[model samples]
Target: MTAKPTANTRTIGSHFTRAGKYAVLSFQAALTIFPIIWVLSNSFRTTDQILTSIRLVPEQFALDNYLNVWRMTSIPRALVNSLTIDIVSILLLLAVVLPLSFVIARFRFRAATVIYLFFSLAVLVPMVTVLPMTFKLFSELGLLGHKYAIAFIYVAEQLPLSVFLMVMFMRTIPSELDEAAIMDGCSILDLFRHVIIPLSRNGIVTIVILSFVAIWNDYLTALVVLSRQADKTLSVVLGYARNEYAVDYGMMSAAIIFAIAPMILIYILVKNRLIKGMAMGAVKG
Candidate 1:
């Protein structure tokens, strides 16, 4: 007969398993971070240096590439445009989805299931599939080449998934809280404002970050929608940064660093909140 493993043997086996997992994760982290570090190093070096060797350390560090990108390129204006669109779109989406998601999660309406299913189906539809129709509508309405038009389009594009996500998160919040609030003579609006909003802060933050990142990195949608140079987003500006003859590796690296800096900063600032939120969500869910 086979012998059962002792507790000490089980503990040793678990240690090895955890150590293996950590080793794998550490290696993956290195792979992910190396490219970013290489780009940053190259952004400080001259074009000739980049062509010669893929080095982690720059021979001659200079800020000229960054200066050129800022002074000569459309990066600055494009950043402003991207920021405006992302922020405005996220606000509009939250405004519409928050209350809608609450109703869908809490209330039992005749068409609630249908509404939820419609949104779930919408998430599977490709944005490209509806582009031609959208373009035609925008052109007819004279909304083409406008920044706010793009922002509104972004909100519409993201709304379905946003609603679904918020609904799921709201479901995780115990209904007992809602019942208690109702018993205290709280109106629906009061319950939503005072109870649900506070509890769902982490989920809302995650949504905002996801939405901002999506809209910020968007290239195809912005390329199709905005015709004017002044209205172009950062992704469009980065595309235009490429040289026709040969890729300016140094300049391109600098532009990329500039483009990703905001996202990196945002993640860094809110990383703790993101982790806590996800953990809470998993437990509550």
Candidate 2:
């Protein structure tokens, strides 16, 4: 028989395995974090310094880039527009999806499977597939220059994944609680508001973050759908700003930072719940 490992040998092996995991995780964290640190540093440095220096940290820092971007670019206007679109898109998404997801999860219906499968397919359809169609449709409908119209597009794009996750997460909530609420003389809408929405908070937050990021970063929809220079979203404005600033690395970097700031802030706010929602296997079939 092969020798059974002694206590000392097993202890060392366990420690070695643990150390390996730590090392790998630390390296992965560095890879993820280094670029953010470098971008932040460069955002504070001049173009010449950025081009010449291979350093992650800047020798000197300045806010001139931010000031120039704020003054020159329509970032402030675009920021407001994007914020408005995101808010509208998210609210609409929640209103439609949460109730639909509750219906799909709580009550068995003939079309539920078909509808869920339809959304699953939608999740797989790339945004580019409908770009031409959307462009033509928006143009035909005289919606080309409309800013809020983008909110509808964002909602449609986000609906599939949001519905999928919310349905799955809602399924994880005990049906007994739902039954209890219904038996307590609660109406269906009241049951949904007090039972489903409260229990599905994690999934709600998760989908909000995902939807916001996708909508905020989407350049093609903004480019194709919203034709007005005055009404473009922040992503499209960033493109114009990049072109205008062409080799001005500092301003470009600052604009990029502005693009990502909202995502970072939202992440910080909901990170714990997001992690718990994702990692706890909350979205189960």
Q: Per-residue lDDT of 1-285 in model 1, one digit per residue for the tens?
A: 234567778899999999999999999999999999999999999888888899988887899889888887788899999998888888888998899899999988899999887766756678888888888888999999677788777887777767767887899999999989999999999999999999988679878876777788898888888878899999988787775213678878888999999989987998886565446444532
Residues 1-285, model 2: lDDT tens digits: 245567778999999999999999999999999988888888899899998886688877889888988988888789988888888888998888898899999997899999888866756678899888988888889887777887878888877778878888899999899889888999999999987898898788888877777687789888888878788889888878756877898888888888889889977987786565545433432
Work out the TM-score per prediction: 0.82, 0.83
What's the lDDT for all of these models?
Answer: 0.84, 0.83
Error of 1 at 125 (Å): 1.0
Query: Which segments of candidate 2 are over 4 A away from where they belong?
Result: 1-28, 272-285
- Backbone clash pairs for candidate 2 read none
Model 2 Cα shift for residue 139 (angstroms): 1.8
Clash totals, every prediction: 0, 0
lDDT of model 1, residue 235: 91
- True lDDT of residue 54, candidate 2: 65
Displacement of residue 175 (Cα, Å) in model 2 is 2.5
